[model samples]
Target: MSIEKHDASVPHTGVGSDLAEEPIGNPGLPAHTWRPTDVDDGAAKRAERQVAAMFVGAMVCSVLFVVVYFTAEIGDNQDVFLGLGASNLGLGLTLGGALLLIGVGVIQWARKLMADHELVEMRHPAKSSEEDVATTVAALSAGAEESGIGRRPLIRNTMIGALGMLGLPAVVALRDLGPTPGDALYSTIWSEGMRVARDVLGTPIKVSDMEIGDLINGQPMAIFEVDEEGEPLVEGVELYVAKSKASVVLVRMEPDEITPGEGRENWSVDGILCYSKICTHVGCPISLYEQQTHHLLCPCHQSTFDLADSARVVFGPAARALPQLPLAVDDEGYLIAQSDFTEPVGPSFWERG
Candidate 1:
């Protein structure tokens, strides 16, 4: 529709019956309020200096972050603050300060030195003429002039320096992700005679201990083991690493109820069998068990496995069965792993087919 538009501020622009319309009173702007930096040249200079100081501070923090990343030790017994490790604490604070100061500096520059006058834009036809395009380019140029970036050499130079230094920490952090985990997932600490122990207490499970339908979470005893001199066999990160691969679930069912796969008919003890507790799809713990059907459910994505049938994936996203741990009874009648899993367990990756 090519109809004429009416405006209260410019009623003469309207024609025909639009003249009798009431004036849509101009809410003119909320009086030209001037900031201290806008009215006083001295205050403006101080604001510029303050913004520059913030940028300089950001650069300093970024440099300190790199220094701490190399110099600090992140050992188990390293210095602690309220409970956090000192290396982690220092790096976190410095990087956080670098980011925060840069943000605050940019905000101060915009609020204190950028154009403060308000211009009301009117509603009109969507298409713009060549004159309107020229007016927009001129307004942007005026905005750039009012922002004072060219005249404020100190703020402009320091801001550039601050932005340049921020990338240093990210490059330094890339080093931490290195040292690949080649062939580490192929085997765990579970050897032929290593006893299946209670997860934390290291209590060995005897063949007579569990009844049919009973399920117990277990791990290789070597993780909680003590040396001949009574020191821990594995501690800290090493202990966690071993536990991740050696974790398992022990379930007992009737021999008639089980369906052993291929040559693995003798992998279980009495009515009991053991499988990795870690799920095949992304390594979530498989805890939800239905003893009746011998189905183990991974709570993460509902991947179900038929434990009786060699832990085969009966449903969901897992590409393979839960890896089974061959079991036996030591002469002492305690449950032990016959050997490490025949193949790698848990989630697969490009390097592991």
Candidate 2:
């Protein structure tokens, strides 16, 4: 509760001489202040109960969150509030409330029950001496004792319950990541009749639209198809997944520069060729094309593929060539996929077998 004024002539053990040479002498700490809970048993008990009550409420909310998760109907016809799904609304509120309660309880515990005394820690070398390590361990033990956690049974148990219950939501939500993608990567939303359209703008491309040495970033029309009101039929996560896997690039080089793969001789139309935009190395979209050399470059890892030679690996980290999409013209003269990619697209994985 008190500290004697230091004799500045004999410098403190760990302090440098420069610190002791300041014009203003050490002011020392102000008088020790005691909180009402620290001096009165009844007030201390009341504060402890209030903190415990908060933790208990957190535990209750966590439990109710689990109950609501299991009971709430999440179908298209399920309950709605203010245009938000009822199940999502309930889960968010309960989880948020529970976390808020635990935070408030911890603040109350520290402010009212934990040690209020202050002590100075001297600056030292980066490497801790053996004596300093022992002192640190002792200080931690003293801090734990001052927090009154051992003496307050109600606070200790409720705080433990609240923290323990908090983990359930995380455990339950891991199920939402869904089952591992199996054979899903082997295919995409690109069907045989699906037409290739420009990315974002969704304008269909034709052989006449592209000139020699031209390359256009494109996506399948299925991802951008609109309903009666012209709103995209595929949207949100489904649209994202479709776009990622079905993305393509249409490139036109001199017909003499093309080197078609075995059985893929007809995969191109005139000088125009279609290839998966996703790099084989790690699935980064490949757009950096050099028309002079007919090479496609992946920026992520500098993986390069030769577009002229069936997108073959030219001079980079990619193990294989980019997958080719067979191209054909619809009656409307728009380029369409003759068939889905013959091989799986994107970076190779263990499940690729």
Candidate 3:
């Protein structure tokens, strides 16, 4: 064995080096050890069966996943355990089991049956030669034999079945994306007379409580409602989804500094305006505010919107402006929604016009 070194002072950018060291002699290959599957027919057969079992299990799980997906009523079903919907639980478990079985099958195949060898290839040209190609094919054939893939039809069939089953979950999940909205993107939970409230807390905001240059994050009142007994009205995944869609940002500036859009003159009071916190580009939450410019920036894609000018897209990848939530004062003088958002919030979707 020999060590090779390069001089520090040399400008070695390309293949040629000013102070290149000599090459070291190659070390001989280590002794090869045969796996139990390779030497023992019984062990090989057992391993094949094990791999086959995993694949069979994976396929069964995939079928169960489909069954769960179709049978589970995801919305308004009201069956809850540990704060999780029963439908969601069933779907997740079946899908997870399917994936896990496939993974374990592959791991077992590689560990107990696949070819295990040690080979040394000399460093040659960057491109492969005719001999290299021929050798590669031969190596693959050898590997297949050593792995007992061709010999063990059961394992091969099972692995193939397991791998094929993986596609079912992906295809089924795609349906959850739903039919493209022709105009759903232009709407939101915001509606006339809806009050703006602190998310989860459901507490209304007073215009006087907000100071100049203040930025307050909020959501729709419906998202944070309670039962008649003050119990949380919505729980689990429904609450999560509602919270995500209804998020908003409230900013207070000088009343004279605002430039409200046409037909939106009364949307603000005392220089306080509210807009969707979600970004228009990829639906990232926008909260980084520049108090002086009244500009909001999305942390995800760096999309910037100028709030003073109808929340217009100022810079970055966002194709549209932030959706504005019209604001009004209730008899109590607290900020309330004059209406829900005029447009949908978050990433551009086909439903959004």
TM-score of each: 0.62, 0.63, 0.55
lDDT of 3 by residue, 80-167 (tens): 7688887778878877887888788878888877766543343456799998899889967866677777777888888788779878
lDDT of each: 0.86, 0.86, 0.78
lDDT of 3: 0.78
Pairs in steric clash, model 1: none
Model 2 bad stretches (over 4 Å): 1-51, 65-96, 107-132, 145-154, 168-186, 197-217, 221-241, 253-266, 269-272, 280-285, 298-302, 316-320, 328-335, 343-353
After superposing candidate 1 on the true structure, give the runs of residues whose Cα lies further than 4 Å from its correct spot.
1-57, 72-118, 122-161, 170-186, 198-201, 206-214, 228-231, 235-241, 254-258, 262-266, 269-271, 282-284, 299-301, 329-333, 342-344, 348-352
Per-residue lDDT over 242-304 for candidate 2, one digit per residue giving the tens place of the 0 to 100 score: 899999999998888888889988888888999999999988988998889988889999988
Ten residues in sequence with the least summed lDDT for candidate 1: 11-20
For every model in order, what is the number of clashing pairs? Answer: 0, 0, 6
Per-residue lDDT of candidate 1, residues 235-322 (tens digit): 9888988999889999999999899999898899998999999999999988789989999999999999999999999999999999
